[model samples]
Target chain A: MSTEPPALSADRRREVRRQALSVGAATGAYGISFGALSVASGLSVWQTQALSLLLFSGGSQFAVVGVLGAGGSGVAAVLTSTLLGVRNGLYALQTSRFLGVTGVRRLAAAQITIDESTAVGVAQPERPAQRIGFWLTGIAVFIGWNVMTLVGALVGNAIGDPRTYGLDAAAAAAFAALLWPRLRSGDAAATAVLAVFVALVTSPLLPPGVPVILAALAAVVVGLRRGGRHEAPPTSRAGELPGADPVP
Target chain B: MTTWTTVLLACAAAYALKLAGYLVPATWVEGERRSRVIALLPVALLAGLVTVQTVVGDGGSLVLDARAAALAVAVGLLLLRANFLVVVAGAALTAGLLRAVGWG
Candidate 1:
């Protein structure tokens, strides 16, 4: 692929921005659920907002809140969140070459390089649009997500019992949604199934957070055992929004 | 540690990992064998989370409750390719209704 950015027609430029904004809006809107779920799990509204502003990755944010809600240790929550955030790192590796960001811009670029922005950035046909798609989607999501998170946290705080609104179940559904797309292959599916069993079996004996970590370790073993087999790397599917549900 | 400390530490770790990608050499994450493992890490952890959330109850004892039913609803919605909000709403509605009706 040529590194040179083809000159975009004005229409193309507008089109890319439109796509970026729309993707940002859609993904950011989901932050409401995150906020509600976070507070229900016992975080203060400000803490929930902090996760949105600082952690920023949708999947990682949910993982942290979910673990803590389940009575997991803080160590467990951090480890789980870190594991989920690894994908964002991989995404950065892919985007950094084209992004060519530096100093403060580099830091800013790193902050917003989650699944949605990376997906939108890579989906564009032209180089300039890629950058535009990345930045616009990142900024838009940043603003929209934080605002919606505050709204959701406030509502959730006001609502009293989370179970009254099934927020617990909502958290489960979020995990299921994130897991669904990753189950594209037999090996991935097998890993998930086994991981679930491991988690369940160990839950009664181990601490809240340890079971998930053990399950992740199991997946590493599986991955290595099956490593040489031909399979599409998960990053190739980066075109799909990381946390976005599949369109019906 | 306090939840506040945990939150900050986790956020810091997440940011560090993201920044590492930009600063570290590409060769570190290169190679199919290693990358494939990296890819499946979330799959495993997420599946574990879903299991724990859906079935494990107080003291981590396995219990089939409204959450299980709600998860079933979530699966059905997912099969129909419902968007994220719809799936979550469907699960929450299902669980809430079940709880209202005195079911687990």
Candidate 2:
């Protein structure tokens, strides 16, 4: 990676900012559902808002609420969320090469280094736009997510019964949509099926969050037996080319 | 521990992992097999989550209820290539309607 960034044209810069902001806005809008769900799942409004502000990663935040909502222990909630958050670390691996920062800037980058930011960052041909895409998207998402989370949390607090509105089903559907795009290859699909089966079989036998954690072993089994052909890391596939597809 | 404790701890762990990626050398984690497993981990976890969320109920009982019907609707929408919000809303409406009609 070159330290000297190629000069970006005004039109190119404008295009990159537009892409980043739109991605951020769409993702942040989705945070409303998370806020409502977290409250319905037994977290206080402050707690839910705190999650959006600090945890920031959509999948990990969802996992925490999901696990806790199912009556799992705090340890299980933390473990499941942490497992989902691991991909952000991997995304950071790619973004670090393009985003060479230090001290306060480096800390800020690490905080916002999520799927959306990394995806938008790497999609750019030039380094300058890449930096803009990453920062603007990250900051936009952070603000939008927190604000929307507060609104949803207030609404959720007012709702009498979450089941009446089918929030539980909405949560399930959210996870399904998130998992749907990842099931392209046969090995990945097989692993998903196996994981689902394991979770179902163990749901009654084990605790709530424990089954999901145990189900992760399917990846190890499948990955070892079947080699991955896709050269680009899986995170790149999660990029939102248009605003329609929202990636967590 | 309290909910606040869990929330704080979880956020810390998640941020720490993200920071670790930026701080650590690429050589430490760059391996084909390792990355493949890491990549597939979320797929497995999310699938498991969908199953649990759809079918499993309080006390970890397997209860095929309106949630199952909602999940079916969600799968159908996904097949139709509906966006994320549409799929979620459709599933919620399905479940809510089914429950309203005196069905599980």
Candidate 3:
């Protein structure tokens, strides 16, 4: 048996860089909306900038600002943000295998494993491509998001009513953009539907962030069941052929 | 809570969640069951988020207002497989039209 490891050649590295740049452009442009809305939600420029730099997850930042704007308690805001951000943990697990780095590099890899980076990395066909994709997208998003936040905050401050300019919808639009492609698959579509159903049905019964968590759990159950079904005998081979060959 | 306290707590919680995944030990992470569940986690989580934002937002009052209309337009755009920018613009335009029409 051959023991040679799968290696990404120089051309593949260039392709990874290109993919990263594309994802970065999309993610960075989306950040403009977050920055504008964070400021419009009554957060100071410094506070908005801090969120972009430290929090770094667009979903969490939007949730926090949305809660705050709605007059929710600070605790509620934090909890909401935390709940939305929980997805990054999942991304971390998926991306870590591609990193192959140890010690400080591993730590750095973990730090940058957000949605954009994870998506770009996971989309690549080769291991080296995955690593390069992840880092480039992560760094690009980080720099681009922070810079756009500053710009949006300043503009939001000057404009006084982002609603009039339609800037407030930026986050939602950005999120929708991210979510749309994922819905293409049957399993993903089922999970999405289940999650929405759970959240909607349970929202009134639970506390601020509790419903979201419960909805996620409900989706997990559905996903697990779906996965279990796929693992059953006949479908096992089915999974290996055409469907599993596609990138997530 | 003070702004600093809130920020600190938020950052701490976010980091804690991130760290929890890493600390779960490679054995646990490597299991087929764990991998299957983790694969579905993001979809479920994001779906929950979208549902909450679109449906029950603010004071637990369900309003089919401008936001909802815009979201509907967005869904349509998404169905068409429109580019991201076009989809966003479509939603914004829907919202603006609703507002102009005194709907919300």
Top candidate, metric DockQ: 2
For residues A40-99, what per-residue lDDT tens digits would candidate 2 score against the true structure? Answer: 899999999889888889888888998888888899899989998888898888889989
| Superposition-based RMSD of candidate 2 using all C-alpha atoms, in angstroms | 2.6
Per-residue lDDT of B90 in model 1? 95
Tens digits of per-residue lDDT, candidate 1, A118-227, equal: 87887776778889989998899889889989998999999999998788988999999888887887778878988998998899999898898888975777788844
**Candidate scoring better on TM-score of 2 and 3:** 2
Lowest lDDT sum, 10 consecutive residues, model 3 chain A, at A239-248
Order the candidates by lDDT, highest first — what do you get?
1, 2, 3
lDDT (Cα, tens digit) per residue for candidate 3, span A96-153: 7767666777766666668778877777777767778889988887887788779878
lDDT string, candidate 3, B2-104, tens digits = 7666666776777666655555655655666556556556567667666665566666555566767777777788788676667666776777677777776
| CA RMSD of each candidate after superposition | 2.8, 2.6, 5.2
Model-by-model DockQ, in order: 0.83, 0.84, 0.48
How high is the DockQ of candidate 1? 0.83
TM-score of chain B of 3: 0.69
Off by over 4 Å in 2: A1-4, A226-247
**For each candidate, what is the lDDT?**
0.86, 0.86, 0.67
Better of 1 and 3 by lDDT: 1
Question: Backbone collision count in every prediction?
Answer: 1, 1, 0
